[model samples]
Target: MALATCATVAGGMADFLVARAMGRMGGGARLPPRVRDMCARLGRPLRERTFSCVLVLRLLPVGSAMMLSIAAGLAGARAAGFIAATLLGSLPQTVVFVLVGGGTEVNHQWQVALAVVLFVISGLGGVWLLRASRIARADRTT
Candidate 1:
């Protein structure tokens, strides 16, 4: 758990630094049109709800963490808020992975089962969060 926490914090900081540099360098101009469009869409919510958006994105296992970091940077999120949210959101999966990995070495079936259950719940929560964010975005636009 300690190692995971440290790694997550380091990784989040690294991502933020890289993305912040890229944003300063006008990196978005080099992106393809489709990616730019996607970024624009993603950026809006991040701008509106910096911490929650970062937390939700981090919780979702589907997207690339680097991409999210870049998007948050481009959207002008503060480093402190972004990093804090990333660490908080990353705890669930980190715990699950640690438990499952340790459990496998000990051949603990219950531990593995609990990890799977946690993973499923996280996925569901991510889906719900995405849907809610989208709805809120639409309402704001209208």
Candidate 2:
């Protein structure tokens, strides 16, 4: 479990570094106009609330991890805050993954069910957080 957690963090950190570098090199110019617009919309909130935005993005399974990292980097998020949020937000999914992986070996139905439940809860929470962030951003603009 500790190894898995460490590996996940390392991978996330690497993704962040790559994105940050790309951002520094005008990566947005390579993206499609639509994607650039979406990134701009998302980027504002991410810039204002770096930690929470990263945490919510990590929790939500909808978007590409690499894209999120890129958007965050382009938004000028601090590395320490981004990494910390990624680590903290990844805990729920990590727990679910560990539980499901171990349960599969033992063929435990209940454990699998619990893992599913946790996954559902995490998804719902991610949605809620995203919505709240959007609303907060709207409020701030008004």
Candidate 3:
């Protein structure tokens, strides 16, 4: 659990920092000027609420980890916020993995059941967050 949570957090932070530096150097070089401008405008709120945004995204488990890390960095998320969110958000998933990996045959059923419950909850919450984010984005655009 410690390895999964802490080590992975370190990896994510590294990815984030590297991506951020890359973003600073020339992240939008290939994008058309119009698209770059639009991305900058849309990234405002994410930059403002970096912790909450990153935390929710880390918890969701829907996208590529590399992409999320890159996006967070490119959007100029705070270092502390990104680290804290990644650490906290990885806990539940680490719990499920630890339980499954260590449990005995007799103990495994309940652990598996708990894992399923957690997964279902995560899925539903991801859907809710996605809808809310879309609505918020729409409202902002309008």
Candidate 4:
């Protein structure tokens, strides 16, 4: 249990930090003029949204964090927001994975349950976040 928890938290934090560094180092800030203008209007709130999206992407598959970090940078989110979002979004999955650590059975039903729960929550959350982002972008346009 402890091992799983540690792995999850460490993995999430690592993903966040790695993404932030890569984003900055890669000059991801060199976005198009339109995006730059949009970001100028976004002010600080953009940072929070970027963090949420990046963290969500990180919790998925391996190497996903790299791509998401780049996306966040290009999208204009700050490092602190990225890290916070990664940690906040990853907490639930980390807990679930840790809870499932005790199962030893190959045919364990609990494992399936855990996977399903994770999938549902992740999918729902992703949709909600995306919608919110779209709304935010639209608001900035007007």
Model 3: per-residue Cα lDDT at residue 139 = 26
Question: For each candidate, what is the lDDT?
Answer: 0.77, 0.77, 0.70, 0.56
Candidate 1 TM-score, C-alpha based: 0.84
**Model 1 C-alpha lDDT per residue in residues 1-142, reported as the tens digit of each score:** 9898889878777866776687789887886786566567777777667787888877887777777777777767777788888888888888889889889766698888998888888878877887777635643673
Q: Candidate 3: TM-score? A: 0.76
Model 3 regions lying over 4 Å from their true place: 27-42, 103-107, 129-142
Worst 10 residues of 2 by lDDT: 133-142
The better-scoring model by TM-score among 1 and 2 is 1
Whole-model lDDT, model 1:
0.77
lDDT for each residue of candidate 3 in 40-93, tens digit (9 for 90 to 100): 653665577667666666677666665666667777878898888788776776
Name the better of 2 and 4 by lDDT.
2
| TM-scores of the models, in the order given | 0.84, 0.83, 0.76, 0.51
RMSD of each: 2.5, 2.5, 4.0, 6.0
Could you tell me how far off, in angstroms, the CA of residue 12 lies in candidate 2 after the best superposition? 1.9
Candidate number that wins on TM-score, 2 or 4: 2
